[model samples]
Target: MLHALINGLGLGLLLAIAVGPIIFSIIKISLGYGKKAGYAFITGVCLCDALLILLGNVAAEVMRSALEYKNLIGIIGGCLFIIMGIYSFFFGKKPDFEKSRDIQVDYRKRDMAKFTLQGFFINLFNPGPLLFWLTTCTTYSFLNTNERILLFSTTLAVVFLTDFLKVNLAQKIKRWLTPPNLAKLHKATALILTLCGVIIASSVILKNFISW
Candidate 1:
């Protein structure tokens, strides 16, 4: 159990540091809306992770088979990322902090719900997380059922805790997140998404065409 907990903590730390669209979104929400919004977003992501863990445990064989078609998953995920990146780059609305202050009491619930759903869908459609869970579950298949459960639960707890910390940190630095800086961040994210898409597509092409 101790070993599992330690391993889980390591995995959680790795997740915390992993750079992706979700991380950017979390920081953006934290800096824009507040810690509550960030918590809502993280909740959605954690729920998805929980669901994936459950599915992997219950349908291990199915997941194993699914992994064989990872390229297809990658293509779909890549396209989604590219589209989101474009939208963020071109049409992303800067959070109106002043306006939010004016109506914060009125719209708090609605905005929290919206941000929660946004986080859920974004993480759900991301192939990276899917593949990550699949691979990790498979790799640790040697462990007993109880041990696996312990590890997974612990890891998820750590992830949520770390995410909460990140939200607080982003909130602390919110002053630096000006409109121009946010725009630049969006552009950089867009480039990363497009590049990821091209890489996934290229991998499929090369796998099919290149012999050597």
Candidate 2:
């Protein structure tokens, strides 16, 4: 259990540090509509992650078998990251803080639900999370079922807590997140994501094709 907790924490931190569209969206929503909206979005992302974890457990053997093709998966995931990074960098809309603040003044239950659903679909359509969960499960296949559960639960808890902190921090510093600053942040995120994709793809190629 202790080992599981530690490993889960490590995995959770890795995820929390990884900048992607979801994190971008969470921060944007938090800055715009407040922490509640951010929480709603994170909840949706967590639920989707939970579903992927469940599926990985139920189909553990299949997932393990699939690992034989990890190079291919890496390639696909890398391409996806590159595409997402490019789109976000070039075409992402600037969040209108004034407009969002107006909406928040009259925020409703249905609006929360809509945000939740937005988070859900955004995460659901992203191949990254599914691939990540699958890879984690396969990598830790030595662990028994109970240990896996412990690790997964701890991981999820840490991720949610970390994301909550991020949202709160963003809300607190939102005044500094002017349009120009946000645009710079968006471009930075895009560069990081694209670089990650390139690295992943290159590592696979070097390992499989390169002699040394």
Candidate 3:
């Protein structure tokens, strides 16, 4: 049990440092929206992780079969990223974070729900997390059922805690950001997102072509 907890901590920390769309989106949402929005977003993300873990453990065979269509998944994920990137780049609403601190903006529940769903799908379509959980489940299959449960629960908790820290940090950093700087940051994040999308989609397509 102790061993499983430690291993789970290591895995969670490893994932926390991983540079991906999820992290960027969290930071962006936190900086642009608010802590509540960030919380909602991470809620969706954590839920997705939990779901993937569950599927990885309970349906390893099914997941293996699903991997056969990974190319399609990659394409869809990539396109989603690309579209999000474009939207963020051009049409993303720039809220006045400085003013938001003093003002009680009535952020709608509908918006929160939308952000939550966005987080869920974005994490879902990302191949890295899916493959990761799948591999982790297979590698740790030696653990007893209780150990497995404890391990994953610990991992999920760590992930959520780390993400919560990130949200707070991003929020703090927003105070120092000027409008021009914020705009530049948004554009940079958008470009990175688009690049990530393109790479994911293109890599799969290229791999398929090479195999033929």
Candidate 4:
């Protein structure tokens, strides 16, 4: 159990660290709404991730033979990572607010249903999470079943917590940066994203060639 839990969480975190669109979405919403709203969105994302995990488990059970195709999983995941990095580098968005003070809208506070739902869909529809799950979830499911589930759940929990923390912290930190510095930060993030793409692509290529 412990082994599964540890393995699951470890893999989840590895994928969570990259500055993906979802992370930027958290920052954008937080800037417009507030820390609470950002956290709410993150909660939605977690639920989405949990759903994906369940789906992966079901798929694993149904398609046991499919799991052995590591190269296929890696190719798909690598392509996703590469695409996301390209998008981030070329066209990523940060939250845009003209004023530092929170918006004075009381309705958004009350009508959080839309916000939460949008957040959830944003994650579910986004390609990154799917590709991330394709590789990571399969890897997790390869372990002992009970252990894998426990590990996946625990790892996902930690990822949700950490991502929530990072997004909120980014919101707070962005407050201090001047426009130029913020622009610089965006550029840096784009570079990091591009780097992630390169790494994933290289891994896929390496795996492909080695098979020959």
The digit string of per-residue lDDT tens for model 1 on 125-203 reads 9876886676556545445677888899988998899888879888554565566765566567556655555655566
**Superior candidate under lDDT, 1 versus 4:** 1
Number of the top lDDT candidate = 3
Clashing pairs in 1: none
Q: Which stretches of candidate 1 lie over 4 Å from their true place?
A: 61-108, 171-212
**After aligning candidate 3 to the native by TM-score, how far in Å is the CA of 21 from where it should be?**
0.5
lDDT of 1: 0.68
Provide the lowest-lDDT 10-residue window in model 3.
96-105
What value does the lDDT take at residue 6 in candidate 2? 86
* Two-way TM-score contest, 2 vs 3, winner: 2
- In model 4, how large is the Cα lDDT of residue 165? 80
Backbone clash pairs for candidate 4 read 5-151, 9-155
lDDT of 4 at 139: 41
What lDDT does the true structure give each of the candidates? 0.68, 0.73, 0.74, 0.65
Q: After superposing candidate 2, which stretches have Cα over 4 Å from the reference?
A: 62-109, 171-212
The ten-residue window of minimal lDDT in model 4 covers: 95-104
